[model samples]
Target: MEWLAPLAETGVARALIAAPTLYLLVNAAHIMGIGVLYGSILALDLRILGLNRSVPLHVIAGFLSRMAAAGAGLAILTGLCLFSVRPVEYAGNAAFLAKLALVAVGLAHALVLHRGIGWRRATTDGHASAALRLSALASIIIWTSAIVAGRWIGFL
Candidate 1:
C-alpha cells in the first residue's frame, strides 16, 4: 500500500489534490460517464428482456454498445485520475474493492454475452434464449451493485 503513496504524490495527482475545484469537475465528469454507460446498458438489457419489441435487437445493440464503450472509456480515465489523487486510501477501501470486483464481473458477463450464441440469436431472430434473458438480468444486478458500491466508497 505504501507503494501507492508515490503515485499519489506524482505531478498529476499533486495538481488534482491541490485543486479541489478540479477534483470536483473530474468527479462530475465521472458521474456523467457512469450515467451514459448505465443508461445505455439498461436500455439494451430492457430490449433483450422484451421491453421494446418493436425495435430490432441489432439496431439497439449496435449504437448502444458503442455509446457504452465510450462511456466506459471516459469513466475509466476519470476514475483512474481520481484514484491517483488518493491511491493508497482507495486501494485499501472495502467499497472500492467491491466496486472493482463488480466491474470485473460486469465486463466478464458482457464478454460472454457478446461471444456466445445469445448475441447472434438476439440480433438475427430478435429473440433470445432463457439463458440470455438471465444474463440480461444479471447484468442489471451486477452493474447496479457496482454503482452502489462506488457510492459507498465515499462513506467508507
Candidate 2:
C-alpha cells in the first residue's frame, strides 16, 4: 500500500493523470496490443489444431509466434504504465489479480512449450503431434480466459 501510493505519484502516472489525451492514446495502444497478441496466438493455435492445413506449419508458426511476441511485449509495457496510474486500487481489484494470474500461467505455458523438444519437432516436421495439439488447445483456453478477465476488470 505504501509503495503503491508512491507508484501512483510517479512521474509517468502524474503525467498520464494530467493529460487525458495521452491516457486515452495509451489505452488504445494497450487494446491494440491485446488484439494483436490474441489474434496471432489464436491463428497459430488453430493451425496446430488442424485448421489451415494448406499452409505450412513451420512458416505460419514462426511468423505468428513473432507477431505474438511483439504484441505481448507492447501489451505488457503499456499495461504497466496504465497500472501505475492507480496502483493501489488496481492492486485490490479481484479481476486484475485474476488477469495477472492467467497471464502468468499463459506465459509459463508458452515458455515450456517453446523450450521443449515438441515445439522444435512440430516446427521442423510441419506436423503437430497429439500432445502438441492438446497444448495448443490449452493455450487457446488460457489466453481467452486472460482476455476475459482483463475485460472484467473495467466492470469491477
Predicted model with the maximum lDDT:
2
Candidate 1 — which pairs collide?
Answer: none
For each candidate, what TM-score against the reference? 0.95, 0.98
- Per-candidate Cα RMSD to the true structure, in Å, reads 1.1, 0.8
Score residue 125 of candidate 2 by CA lDDT.
88
lDDT string, candidate 2, 18-84, tens digits: 9999999999999999999999999999999999799999888888999999999999999999999
Clashes of each: 0, 0
Residue-by-residue lDDT tens digits, candidate 1, 116-156: 88888787777778998889899999999999999999999
Model 1: residue 155 alpha-carbon error in angstroms:
1.2
TM-score, structure 2 vs. true:
0.98
